[model samples]
Target: MDNNKLIEYLETFGALTSKDKLCLIDNVEFKAYKAGDVFLHTGKIANQVGFIIEGVFRYFFYDGQGNEITSYFMSENQFVTNITSFNEYTFSSGTIAAETDCLVLIIDRKGWELFAEQIENWNSIISKITSKTLLEKTNFQRRLINQDAKASYLSLLEQNPSIINRVPQTHIASFLGITKFSLSRIRNQIANK
Candidate 1:
C-alpha cells in the first residue's frame, strides 16, 4: 500500500522516526469501499479505524423520527472512526458510510493497541489528533446551530468547496439540517444573486 499520504499527515502532529513510520505502516491494511458502503453501523462496536487516502465518508444516524441525520463528513487525509466505540469498545451512536468510492488504510483494535505499546510518543501524537478533531467537530456544530439554512450552506461551501460536487445533494441537505427542496432553492437564490 502507498503510505506517503499517511506519513505526511502523521508528520503534521509530530516528528516520527523512520522506524516509527515503518511500524505504523506495518500495522495497517489497505482497503477499498464502494460508495454507500457502511463501515460502522449504528449500535455496532467499531473494531477498526480508517485513514482516508481518497474520497469521503459521512457520519450519520437516524433520529427518533427515523430520518437520517448527517453529523459530519470525513474526507481525504482525515481519520475516520467512532472514537467512543473504538476506544471504549462500546456501540457507536452513528454510522459511518462512504459517500464516494474510497481508499483507506485500516488498523484494527489489536493492531492499534500493539502500535501504541510499541511507540513511546504514540499517546501524545494521538492526543494532538484527538484535540484537533474535537475542535473541528465542535466548530462545525456551533456554526450550524447559529446559521440559517442558506447561511449554513454558504459556510459549508466556504469550508469545503468541493463537497457540493463530491457528495450527493441529499446528504448535503441532511448535513445542513435542511430539506432537499430548501437546499435547491437556496442554491438557486445564491446563483441568481
Candidate 2:
C-alpha cells in the first residue's frame, strides 16, 4: 500500500537504504482499480509497470471467436507488465485486468529510467529481477510441457493454495490448461483423496 512495501520487496534482492525507499516514493505513484477494470488492454502500448499492493490481475487474450483465454494470474506483491511491449515498444498482445479491487504502485518508463540511474546497484537489481521472472516463466513452461492437468493443478495448489480462494475457477482452469468442468472434477478428486 506504500513505498515501504515496495522497498521491502526490493530488499529481497539485496540491502537497500532509507534513501532508496525515498527515491522510490519520489518516482512511483499509487493507483487504485475496481474489480473488472482494465489495467492494460490488448493493442495498447504499456509504458508503465505496476507492483500489486493488493488484489489479483489476470493476463488474457481473446481468441478468434472472441472467447477470453486467460494466460496467467498475478496476485499481491508481484510486478505486472507487458514484457514484450515494454521491451520493444510495441502494442501489447495480451490484456491485464483487475480480478478484484486493487491498489498498485506504478512507475512509468521515464520514472524507471531515473530510478535506475539514481538507485545504487540498479543494474544488479535488474539482473536479479530478470532472473526471477525467467525462473517463473521456465517453471510455467515446464509444467505445460511435462505435467498433466491434474499434476499442474496440484503443483499450483502446493505453491499457492490461496489461488483457489482468490481467483475464479475459469481463470484457474485456463492457467492449468483445463476447462472449468475439468477443474471442478479435479477439485472433487482431490477432495475425495
Candidate 3:
C-alpha cells in the first residue's frame, strides 16, 4: 500500500518519529470501498478509523420519518470514524458510506492500542488529529446553522469545488438541508449569475 498520503496528512498535525511512522505503516491495512458501500453502519461499533487515500464518504443518519439525512462529508486526507463510538466502544448513531469509490488505510482498535504502548508520541499525535477533526465538524455544523441552503451549498463549493462532481445531488441536498428540487434551482440560479 502506498501510504505516503497518510503519512503526509499525519505530519500536518505533528511530527512522527521514524519509529512512530514505521509502526503506523506496519499496523495499517489498505481497503477499498465501491461507491455507496457502507464503511460504518449505525448500531455497530466503530472499531476502526480510516484515513482516506482517494474519494469521498458521507456521514448520515435516519430521521424520525426514516429519511436519511446527511450530516457530513469526508474526502481525501480526512479521517473517517465516529470518534466517540470508536473511543468509548459504543454503537455508532450514524452511518458512513463511500460517496465515490474509495481507497483508505485503516487502523483497527487493536492496532491503535498497540501503538499507544509501542510509540512514544502516539497519544499526542492522535489527540491533535482528534481535536482537529472535531473542530472542523463543529465549525461546519455551525456554518450550516447560520446559513440558508443556497449559501451553505455555495460555501461547500468554495471549500471543495470538486465535491459537486464527486457526490450525488441527493446527498448534497440532504447535507445542505434542502430538497433535490431546491438544489437544482440553486444551481441554476448560480449558473445564471
Candidate 3 per-residue C-alpha lDDT over 65-174 given as tens digits, one digit per residue, 9 for 90 to 100: 99999988999888899988999999999999999999999999999899889887778888998888788778887988999888988889987787888999999999
Per-candidate TM equals: 0.96, 0.92, 0.95
User: How well does candidate 2 score on lDDT at residue 127?
Assistant: 76
- The C-alpha stretches of model 1 lying farther than 4 A from their native spots are none
Better of 1 and 2 by TM-score: 1
**Comparing 1 and 3 on TM-score, the stronger one:** 1
lDDT of 3 at 134: 83
Question: Which runs of model 2 end up more than 4 angstroms from their true locations?
Answer: none
Look at candidate 1 and tell me the lDDT of residue 6: 83
Clashes of 3: 0
- Quote the lDDT for 167 in model 3: 93
| True lDDT of residue 176, candidate 2 | 77
Q: Rate the local accuracy (lDDT) of all candidates.
A: 0.91, 0.85, 0.90
Best of the two (1, 2) by lDDT: 1
Q: Candidate 1's residue-wise lDDT over 1-193, tens digit each?
A: 6888987887888888888888988889999999999999999999998999999999999999999999899999899999999999899999999999999999899888987898777888888999999998899889999989999999999988867889999999999989999999999999999
Per-residue C-alpha lDDT of model 2 across residues 9-107, encoded as one tens digit per residue: 888887777787788898899999998999899999999999989888989998899978988778777888887798789999999999888899999
